[model samples]
Structures are given as C-alpha cells and as structure tokens.
Target chain A: MPYVNVKITNEGATPTQKAEVIAGITELLQRVLGKNPATTVVVIEEVDTDNWGIGGEPVTLRRRRGL
Target chain B: MPYVNVKITNEGATPTQKAEVIAGITELLQRVLGKNPATTVVVIEEVDTDNWGIGGEPVTLRRRRGL
Candidate 1:
C-alpha cells in the first residue's frame, strides 16, 4: 500500500478541491507506478501558516514580510 | 530533511496532543535516521470518518455496520 501525504497551507481550500486532489493523486500513482487505487491511501493536511516554516522562519512571518 | 505525516480519525485530539505527536516523531527520526529536527517536518491530519476508507469501504459505513 502506498501512502501519500499532501501538505498545503490553510488557505480555505474547498471540499471539491480536496476531493479533486485526492482523486488526482490516486490516478497519478496508478498511471505511473501501477499502484492499486483501492490500497493507496492519500492524506491531505492543511497546516496553519504559523506552524509551517521555511528558511528557518514560519510562513506567517514570511508572508508578513512579503517574502 | 525528513517529512512525516500522521493521519488519524477526527476524534477530538487537542493541540497539546498534536504537538506531542510532532515532537515525538521528530525525536524518533533524529534518533533513528539522524535527521535534523529543525528541518524535519511532521504534519498531522485528522480525517473525517466518511473520508477514511478501509477494506473497500469508508470508516463511517464500517462503523455503522459494526465491522
């Protein structure tokens, strides 16, 4: 079983968008890796900007500084 | 950098619990794989029962059928 995790900043992604992402990733793995969609687990995580970091700083501060 | 994603059913896990999970995973990676905690990313995704699937059925249906 292939477990895929997609992490994205919490920017109000709609349910439809989340569904599409799950389907797309499942289909991609099936097409490219011959993986079974039924056994493949795709998890989507929407992280708060304050908890997401880059370049040793949180995304909130990065966005605040317009970086 | 090692990225770890923990997926669990939406069961009222508190922020403190989530933080502990992150910290625990980070420390585990550091001890086992020599990964840097600063660069290690741990994401926790609490999925709805309706969305989580097992054995060709959603968890919601499985729970309803008492499987």
Candidate 2:
C-alpha cells in the first residue's frame, strides 16, 4: 500500500496549481517507482502561512522570532 | 515542496515498524526519484481500524455492511 500524500505550504500556489502539482507527482511516482496509479492516492494539503517550515525550523516561528 | 505524508491504516504495525517503513520509502525516493533525503519530510500517520479503504470501498464500511 504505497499511498503518497503530498503536503504543500506556499502562498503563491492556487488550487489549480496544487492539483497540477499532485498530478505531476502522481505521474512521476507511477512512471519511476512502478506504483499503480489507481491505488495511489495523492492528497494535497495547502497549509496557510502560519503553518510551514524550512531548514528544520518552522517558517512562521522563524519569521516571528527573526531567526 | 516535496514533503511526503504516508498514512497507514491497518491492525498489524507498531510505531517502530512504521518508522522503518518510512525510512525505507525515503531511501527508495532518494535512490529512484533523485530526491534529497535531508529535505525530504516524511510523516507517517497510523490510523485505527476505522479509516481505511481498499478496492474502491471503505474497509470499515464494507465490514459493517457485510458487502
């Protein structure tokens, strides 16, 4: 059961962009990993600006604390 | 942007087993997808016996309905 869930947190991507991203990733997984596309469920979670991280640190916290 | 969220729902896995599964998948991604392991955020959410599906049907619902 190889269900790939994709979570994206960025301010510049719209719903269409999110859909396209998931579709592209799904295709990649199918082609590269030989995973069945039918069973692979790609979930795209669009996190707001308050819940994101980069470089082992939360983006919001880093911005708020100036770290 | 390439955060992989793995959600497993079954009655046959412990936390350490789940972690190993994630680690194995991460290695596969790094080797096959050419993704950087350092930046790859792999989240494993273990679900109880309620929220699982198979063959275009919910497992719990199917069990309850005897379908």
Candidate 3:
C-alpha cells in the first residue's frame, strides 16, 4: 500500500482543488510505480501559517516582513 | 525543522484524540531528534475504510467477513 501525504499552506484551497490534488497524486503513483489505486491513500493537510516555518521564522512573520 | 504526517484509519477519531497524536509526535521528535517544536509541523489524516485495503481486499469488505 502506498500512502501519500501532501502538506499545503492554508491559502484557502477549495474542496474541488483538494479533490484534484488527491486524484493527481494517486494517478502519478499508479503511473510511476504501478501501484493499485484501490490501495493507494492520498491525504492533503492544510497547515496554519503560524504553525509552519522556514529559516527559523513562521510563514506568517516571513510574509509580514516581505520575505 | 521537522514535518510529521500521521495517517490513521477512520475509526471515528475525536478532536481530542487527534490532538494527542499531534502532541505526542512533536514531543517524540523533540526528545529523540532534538527538533524544535516551533518549527515542527504535525498533521493527521483519516482515511476511509473502503479506500484502504490489504491483501487486495478493502478494509470494509474484510470487516464484513470478520477478517
């Protein structure tokens, strides 16, 4: 079984967009690894800007600083 | 910075339970790997039984057959 997890910044992704992401990831895995779609699990998690950071600064703060 | 993704079978996990999972994972990473909690991200995703399978049979079907 292939379990794919995707993390997208909380930029207000709609339901349709999320569905497409799941479908696309599943298709990619199937085409590349010949994995069965039935056994493939694709999960998308939208994280808060404050909880996600890079370069020792939260995304929220980084955005405020124009970085 | 560490990003942790947790996938759990959708057996009606409550918000409290999910929180615990997130917290526990963050703590484990901090204790073992010395990851900073502020930059650590933990996301939990629940998968449907019908979409999750093992041995070429969906989990839902396996449950029905008591397998």
Clashing pairs in 3: none
DockQ winner between candidates 2 and 3: 2
* DockQ of candidate 1 (2 decimals): 0.14
Comparing 1 with 2 on lDDT, the higher-scoring candidate is 1
Against the native chain B, each candidate's TM-score is 0.85, 0.64, 0.91
Tell me how each candidate scores on DockQ against the true complex: 0.14, 0.23, 0.08
Off by over 4 Å in 2: A53-57, A61-67, B6-38, B42-53, B56-67
- Tens-place lDDT per residue, model 1, B1-67, is 9988777989799999999999999999999989999999998878876556443344565588886
Candidate 3 regions exceeding 4 Å error are A1-6, A9-11, A14-67
* Weakest lDDT window of 10 consecutive positions for candidate 2 chain A: A26-35
Please state the CAPRI-style docking class of candidate 2. incorrect
Q: lDDT for every model?
A: 0.78, 0.61, 0.75
Best by TM-score: 1
Model 3 TM-score (2 dp): 0.55
lDDT by residue for model 2 (A1-67), tens: 4466765555455566556655665565455445456766777665775667686777677667864
Top candidate, metric DockQ:
2
Each candidate's interface RMSD (Å, one decimal) is 3.9, 6.8, 6.2
What tens digits encode model 2's per-residue C-alpha lDDT throughout B1-67? 3478765555466666656655665665555445557776778676664667676767677667874
lDDT of 3 at A27: 92
